[model samples]
Target chain A: MFNIFKLAARNLRRYKRRTLLTSILITLGVVAVLLFVSVSGSFKAMMIGQITDSMLGHLQVHSRGYLSSIDSLPLHLNMKGEQVVRVKEILDGNDAVEAYSMRIRLGAMFSNFTETTNVRLNAVDPEQEMQTVPMLADRIIKGKKEGLLAKGEILVPELIARGMKVKIGDTIVLVATNKHGSVNGQPFVVRGILEGISGPGGRDGFIHTDDALALLRIEGREISEIAIRLNEMEQMHEVFDELKGQLESSRNKMDKPVFEVHTWEELSPFFNIARMIDLMTLFIKIMLVAIVLVSIMNVMVMAVYERINEIGTIAAIGTGPGKILSLFVAEGFLLGLFGTLIGVVISLITIAGMNAAQISFDFGRQKGLLLSPTIASGEVIVIAGIVIAIAVLGSLQPAWKAAGMDPITALRHV
Target chain B: MTLVTAKGLEKTYIAGDITVRAIRGVDFTIEPASFVCFIGPSGSGKSTLLNMIGCLDPPTSGFLEVAGKDVTHLGAKESARFRGDHIGFIFQDFNLIPVLTVFENIEYPLQMVQNWPALKRKQRVNELLEAVAMKDQGGKFPNQISGGQKQRVAVARALVTNASLVLADEPTANLDTETANRIISLMKQMRDEFGTTFIFSTHDHRVVKSAEKIFTLEDGKLQQQGNGDNHV
Candidate 1:
């Protein structure tokens, strides 16, 4: 085996240009597969990180009617103010719950001068919301926490703030629709500019807890949802089970009657679509690998045909058929092996350079999205294994032909 | 003892609709260390008979034995291994592996049949190169060498395994008279020194003159066997 291997290696060197070209082709194919797989993986990781950490906590508890609302009503979870406190306490006791908070989501309109736009407003506690969603603090571009706590003060999304022409310290009219379909209007002062959530359709505006209650004329109303942030995204089910067990054992009638659970995966279907896209990207990668396999097979066929006489000579000189087969197949395997290594190195370098350049693309719907590159070691191993398999499979027919050749005819073939 | 003995050996090849009989009911023997030649015109089956004796092809029927092994019914790979271990061939056109240098080409059979150490392989290759008077040209590829020099290297390559028989098919048909004499003299000298039997096919009377025993082949049958001067 070793002798034939050395001979095979030497033979490859004889056709230096052809071997190098095949190696380069294999490298390019491998890089394409690795690059697509890695970038899709990175995109998935980034999107999940954003959702689980900054927007929807690991899970949320909402009222059944509130989830599918046809009529505009305050279908709150109907947990009393004390019940909200108790639920938060129960969640905070669990090890999986990194933090917990409550929010009152309402639909309202913000008006400044002559402009008015409908906004989904979230009224949250400053202290607990900071623990559940750290981006809340990161979004505070101006003003202090003291000012955000002042009644009748609000912070607005950058897009809505820009359109409303309402800066810090400017007063805007807030109109809230009550459960009876009547509107109540109140004046509110903008406290700060919020940033970081950049899509065109994220929630538009946010007001403080006391100010939103006054505008809606619901001073004694219960909170609508309980949001829990788990330390690990994978722990959502475990924590939900724990929460359910706690609620069941407690004498909490309201918590049992109206609450429903949701993880971040359910709240946003974008995560699911992102996962599906990742699978599709892998499929495309497999197709490219198949093309590489075919190219290698073609090269092997040419090589076997060209070396027919030589194969016969070697066989006539007492080399075993199995050894000859190993030799030819080893040539193919080495081709794939060399090609894959080159491809991996090229891909890593290219991806690194592209990432260093910070290249961004205007993907229309996902404008200003940056193309990020990433590949874990495990993914590299899988790609290498796949390319090797393709190379061996591609060489099978030609190697068998070389092995089965008749020595006399081959020697006489000129 | 006779190194090769055959009786009623027959061989037929099918080419499309034409079934060509290259050898028919032939009985022959080649003694050890003898310079033997099979002389005939084209289509006389000299090469075909050589192929059968060298174990490159199987005889169609009847008893055929070389070095005491019956090869009439041997399988393809078995015949190949048998030929590689026991026989060396010198074709009219020198069939040196073109990609390999002369030294590597000579070392090929040794590497195939024997698990010799690198030192042993190097020593054997150099010794054969010296015997062929190609010591200085061992590094040259077959294409880079002259026709005569390539045949010298081919001789060295074939004899490197120390096989008991060397079959040369039209070995001198491509060479000038002087070069052919030199090649025939080299084969005779190698046979004398190593006790290697020489069985070659040739039409040149000059090649036949150098052989101690000669066989006249016509229409795929052995017609005559005599001493060197009988044809002359």
Candidate 2:
């Protein structure tokens, strides 16, 4: 076996120019795939971090019918006092849960003395909200990140603030209708202006929970939803499943499920775009396969054709057909192996260079966000294995043909 | 004992309704440790006969045996194994693999066909290189050597597996008169030392004079048999 590999290597070296060209082509294909996978993977991960950490909070729980009418911020679908207590109990018992924020979502009318417009608002406790969605303070473009929002204070969306010509420390009036057909108004100081994200919750403002309850005339601890953070982001599904199973069994007077748990993927529209990135990565991998197949097959076929007399001499001297087949296949395998090694090394160096340069780009209203590209070792191994396997497959036909050649006829070939 | 026996051998090739008979029915037997030659003009089936005897080509019809084994109808794998075990071949063009050193070229049959251990294979290859008078040139490639040296390397490669019968098809056709004589002397010496049978085909009268026995063929049929120095 070692002799066969040595002979295969020598044969590849016999045609230096052809071997180099084929190797370069395969190397380029590998480099293209690895680089794309790393860069696009980094982009997707960073964007997901921004969305989940700033707004979605990894997972969310709501009253059974709340999400269906979430856009309208329906007060009638809010979880009552006892239901909220049951949901908290379930969340608090799960070791995976790191923190959670209870929120009251409602639609209100915002006025800056001259202009009035509809605005969606989330009422939260500043400390709990910060723990559940830590990046929330990072999105505060114009005010303090420490306090988030105090009682009687609100964080206005940048779009709404700019449109109403309002700024931090300015007083604004919010008018809202309660579920009982009563209307109330409250004036609050603006604490901050928030940068908008790209999807569903982009235009919502924030306020303190105490202020929200007072203005809505709520008598008890009713809440619209619970946003949850986990000890590890990867544990989102496990915790979500456990909580969902437990909450599904909790029932109201009608004996229907009282709560629905959702991961950030289910709640955000950006996941579709993430899936698109994955699909594109798959297509790139397929293209890499095609490139390896054609290039290695072409080189092996030519090698067989050019070495007919040598093959005949070996075969006539009693070298078996299997040995001949393995010789050619080994050449193809070596080609893939060399190319993949070089490509992976170059890709790693390039990724390191990018990180050193601190390449940054803007996504939506987030500016100068650092892009860190990285590839897992397992991914590198899988890609390399694919290339080498494809190369072996590519050379099989030509190698078989070489092995099965009639020695008498092949010897006569000039 | 007879090392090779072929009775009523025949070979035919077909091409889209046309038939060509390269070798017709023939009968012969070769003894162990004999130096034999098959002589014929062009298109006289000398090579076809050698190919059949070497198991490189199957005869269309005949009783053909090598080393007391009937090889008239062996499968591809069986034929390859049989050839590796009992027969060696040297081609007219000194068809040494260009990519290998002379030492590696000789080691090929042992390593690839017989799966010999590396240390023993190296020792045997060195022995053959010395016997071929190419011991010092073992590290050189085929193209780096002379035509005679290349043929010597081919000779060493053929006998490396210790095959009992070595067949050379027009072995000296490409060499000059002096080199041809030297190669023939080398083969006879190898046969004397190893007790291996040598069979070759040649049109050269000089090579014919050295053979102990000769069989002459014409139009794919055996026409005459004679001892060395006897005219056709």
Specify the poorest-scoring 10-residue window by lDDT in model 1 chain B: B108-117
Clashing pairs for predicted structure model 1, backbone only: none
lDDT (Cα, tens digit) per residue for candidate 2, span B89-188: 9888999889989998898889889999989999999999999999999999988999999999888888888889999988998999899999999999
lDDT of 2 by residue, A1-414 (tens): 788899999999999999999999999999999999999999999899888888889899999889999988899999898888898898899999999999999999999999999999999999999999899998999988888989999999999999999999999999999999799999999999998998778779999999999989999898998999999998888888899899999887999888899999999988999999999999999999999999999999999999999889888888899999999999999999989999999999999999999999987776788989999999999999999999999999999999999998899999
Per DockQ, the best of the predicted structures is 2
In the range A1-414, model 1's lDDT, one tens digit per residue, is 677777777777777888898888888888888888877777777666655556677788765556555134263434566666767678767888888767777878778969999877778777677788665655566766443445677878777887778788898888888655678998888888776452311444567777667776776756777778888877778878777766655453565444566777767766677879777977877786787678778888988888877876777666767777888788888888999999999889988998999877653233566778788899899889889888888888888988888877777775
Global fold similarity of model 1 (TM-score): 0.81
Which window of 10 residues has the lowest lDDT sum in candidate 2 chain A? A362-371
Model 2: per-residue Cα lDDT at residue B178: 93
Docking class of 1: acceptable
lDDT of 1 at A205: 59
Error of 1 at A365 (Å): 7.7
Which candidate leads the pack in TM-score? 2
